[model samples]
Target: MWPFTKRPKDPVLDPSYGDPHRKALIRALEKRKWKFARELLNMAADPDEMAFLMEAVGGVDGIQDWIGDWMDAEPESTLPVLVAGCHAVRWAWEARGGKRAKYTTAAQFKGFHERLRHAEALLQRVLAREPDNVTARAWLVTSSRGLGVGPAEARQRFEAVTRLHPGHLVAHEQRLQYLCAKWSGSHEEMFDFARGAATAAGPNSLLHELVAVAHIEKWDATEREEGNEYIVSDEVRAELLTAAEDSIFHPDYVPAGPGWAPRVATFAMAFELADEFDAAGHAFALLDGLVTEWPWQILGDPVEKFTASRDWVTTNRS
Candidate 1:
């Protein structure tokens, strides 16, 4: 009677036609209309949409409310809602740009801060459910660092990640940077850890940089005759140069990976230290080419500029 003898299903009326009601609610929240969004969420037919909407607005509190209500109404199937809430919060954070703030307006910053709190709560929930979730643990570490949590807490999180997944390159790299910045140990101890991490992690460019820095620090500590520049001893400098050279062509030195630009930058530094103007010039040329070839991959353009300036100085001085 509605259309024909057997009525055809209306595609536009289907739940999957438009964006999921939950995603629409999230969009509305991002635009800062909490009241109307809540009303629309109340009218949402899908339980999953309602669960995601609750979590989107209320974070842990909303999740707990949904869990309580779901337990009373349908005890057999409440877990999915909890899980969906976790995923919703994770999606919200990731959609906002993965632990980094890219706020262009005051409204954007306010929204980001709210979403960050939600993300942290979701990660906490995930950890509670699966204490050994290495990915969640890594995200927690990154979130804490983003929120300006102390270095000790950050170190603990990074250590936990490496403990769970020893081969996590980003965690290892962060831990190395942390130790180098907070160097309180004897030079020998620092060098030992640096070398061990470099070996285990398979030729980290930061390791070479730290090793060169350690040599420079040692050079500073030693006796220097008046009017003589305090260059790292030739042996240590050569060792660092060789390490830098190896880093550039190492098995893991893919085009946009960790070892490319930093290795070239380190080589330029080493050449400048050895007073090899021509070699430094060649290294600088290589770096300049990288900037053009892989512009977005390069992390610190200022470092490249500094290296180029030094190469020019060395060339002109000769």
Candidate 2:
């Protein structure tokens, strides 16, 4: 049965789920107060926080149009340049639409490539001035795939960031997308990369969710019944349990900046699908009433699926 037939109050569907300061930055951008955005970016506590801030800025609609004002105002700062380049990548994908290649029109593909090229040029300029800009380097990793630079160049761009900050979550997540079977790699490659990264990352790191992400990708590709079977199988259940234990369940674990909510929500969904209601319930508990748009959006309405899953876990967990 479809779960969204009736609705309760909508869940908090915040994209910048874990970050309290994200709204102020977005408001500043909405008002074209670019200097305020620059101040927020400059004050970011670390690379992860900085990357998250840029990602939030990059996702705003029409940001590309007025971002140039910021670029003009701060000729010497790479901050606006990074924001422009990041938004260009997002805008390129918007041109491409969300459909597979077969469903996409040629003109859309042309616009996608053109925008990506513009993004690449801007990102390269930032790198030229600041070679150690791992945030710029990570966005470059994303654009490499869109530009069809192939696996070698993609890995090289990913390595450039990891060498500087080995645990850079955004960079690792982007590379994982590149490695997915739907993209450049096969299922074997995807799982291998996810498992290896999870193990290599330090204890309590959210990298363990990479394993859940891999399984979710595989689930998305398979037919419904078979996918359900695979996700609920004993092996998958055990692996997810192990991943939970190593990461979110670890006593030392603390949610990592803005990325934490989505990662937890991901594990919650995987657990519910795998029929490990207890684990799912715990994750939902961690989330309180908050929800993010992705992974659940893959199912249907993110809020509906999230609410249904959380409710189901509450009712069914032992």
Candidate 3:
């Protein structure tokens, strides 16, 4: 028998929720087996599933190096070009970094826009072949921001996706980014968009968590104590609880594969911020130690943030 090796007691912070299919696809790509990746994309049950899998593909480092071979091998397939295009959009942001414009070098900005245009061209080709393609259209929404396409054009791209798949979570998330204050919007616009989308998506829809996301964004943009006050305000706390009930806590609500953790994480963080320890504990109980990097990482190290918050809820909850 092998030795029993103990693993570190850290919460595994994964954006993909350690999804089995995502793991398989990444392993296949690392082995240069594009066919396996192709099979995985083809097997996605719906547009949202496809988009979720494709986003994972796009984040694979150096996919640009060999994805062209997949494109060449499957000339008739839109999947390769779609995969490559999404990667380019993510690649564009990699060039831009996550820092504000003033902190970025001119060369980084130049590379950023150049890659976005390339991503646009590739995505456009995919759309030409399959106009109703939600994944390609969603990436274009992201590229529109990097390319400085006016809000009008961005809205058009987003509407195109909605016209096809109304409850598209990825597109809604991307559109939320476009409506953020750092982009072409104000906090008012961001909140308006978030509330409208959440209401429209209705009960059992993950989009309801967009309300939690909006609160997080506003808090992140405000001064420290003031942000905490805003999050813990009675009005905000009530809104978050209502939104959570409409989605995560609803009787019919079910967690979808790979996309479940982030939505729950958003509510968990929101409850923690609101100092609603009982609700926060309930959210963490649902998560059962799973973690996503966003709302938590926005405050501090994701694992540490998750551990601290979970511990606090355990200690303080009635």
Q: Which residue window of length 10 is worst by lDDT in model 2?
A: 1-10
lDDT of 2 at 2: 15
Question: What TM-score, over all chains together, does every model reach?
Answer: 0.43, 0.94, 0.93
The best-first sequence of candidates by lDDT reads: 2, 3, 1
The lDDT of model 3 is 0.85
Tell me the deviation in Å of residue 149 in model 1.
9.0
lDDT of model 1 at position 294: 19
Backbone Cα, N, C clashes tallied per candidate: 0, 0, 0
Best candidate according to TM-score: 2
Error of 2 at 89 (Å): 1.3
Where is the poorest 10-residue window by lDDT in model 1?
A: 8-17
Residue 303, model 1: Cα distance from true site in angstroms: 6.7
lDDT of 2 at 272: 95
lDDT of 2 at 257: 66
Query: Is 2 or 3 the stronger prediction by TM-score?
Result: 2
- The digit string of per-residue lDDT tens for model 2 on 44-143 reads 8888888778778876888888888888888998888989998899899999987777899999999999999999999999999999998889999889
User: Which regions of candidate 3 deviate over 4 angstroms?
Assistant: 1-10
